[model samples]
Target: MGGPSEEPELWAFLESLHCGDILSGTVTAIERFGVFVALDDGPAHSVFPGVGFISFAELSSRRFEAASDVVQVGRRVSCEFLQFDTWNLEARLSLKATQPDPFQLFVDAIAVGEKLPGQVTKLIPFGAFVQVADGVEGLVHLRELAWTPVETPSDVVQVGDEITVVVTEIDRERHRVALSRRQGSSAV
Candidate 1:
């Protein structure tokens, strides 16, 4: 066999698993791209100690600087089986799937046209990102920075400035919040 078919036993074992099934494993390696796990019930990987892999995005819903931010080597974890990586001959798992999604919770509790107090966290050329809640940020576009014409987001609001904003649009599918400081000021 060639390509992904090189590991028949591993392929058959991974094929037996289903998405959302809970898989137990020990953290084997942490790479910039993802984490590798030694699954408790699956056959050994041809190279790695484990046949389970978790990409950085699947490690957690929260933003992090490194793989160690969510897990460490030798830590035991239970993750949701997401899919089989036919190319790598590994099972793809999600640690975040086993935990609550903060974005979802935030969305459920908020509504459009709501006024919120937030602190500017990042200032980009087009807009500024304001943190309304922990790990929850909304964008205040340059045009919405103020009623007056502005060349850049910094001209209206600098990073770390506390400001009030009105939620103009809530994109549930895209996990985005479009805000307007001008509307918020007028609404106050």
Candidate 2:
């Protein structure tokens, strides 16, 4: 009764959600606390779930003193739904939740002498996030994304760009896999 006509109907949609999945949602309400959006569902009647959520910390970039400065009611917004609280009936979301730092899977599966194709999920001044396997990603730092100096990772790669990468270092405890684009380029 709370979710959809059939509970199973929503499983596919919910299954799509990873802990740090970042998706685009539409703004429905803008309050002093944060912004809320309606997340579009699949072919079914497009459930109008609360989607957009911007916390106080996310306003650091714009110095958003108030919610009004940050968002306008009924505007389309892109943010990450970090998690959904079933008991509370609230979605814990954030713009940064898309990546939510790095996970240990990459470091665990990677070996020093292996190669993996990395799809760039993000390009930043410092480094880039590459999806090696579903739910697992590796990081290609600015110095490793290219053979030459790159002031910005975007210059060498962009979000969704596919590149070859080599597993250079793996810190299993920290769960971070250091990747190198230059090292794997020749193999590709």
Model number with the top TM-score: 1
Residue runs of model 1 more than 4 Å from their true location after superposition: 1-8, 186-188
lDDT for residue 70 in candidate 1, whole number 0-100: 90
lDDT per residue, candidate 2, 1-188, as tens digits?
34544555444465567766666766677666666666664322233336334666653232235777656777765666676544333455675444333354345545896988879987766999887775566788888877778799988787988888888887766556788898987623
TM-score (C-alpha) between model 2 and the true structure: 0.44
Give all candidates' CA lDDT scores: 0.88, 0.65
- Candidate 2 residue 169 Cα shift, in angstroms, is 1.0
Tens digits of per-residue lDDT for model 1 on 114-154?
99999999998899999888778999999999988899987
Off by more than 4 A, model 2: 1-108
Give the local distance difference test score of model 2. Answer: 0.65
User: Candidate 1, 2: how far from true, in Å?
Assistant: 7.7
After best superposition, candidate 2 residue 76: deviation in angstroms? 32
| TM value for model 1 | 0.88
Error in Å for residue 47 of model 2: 26
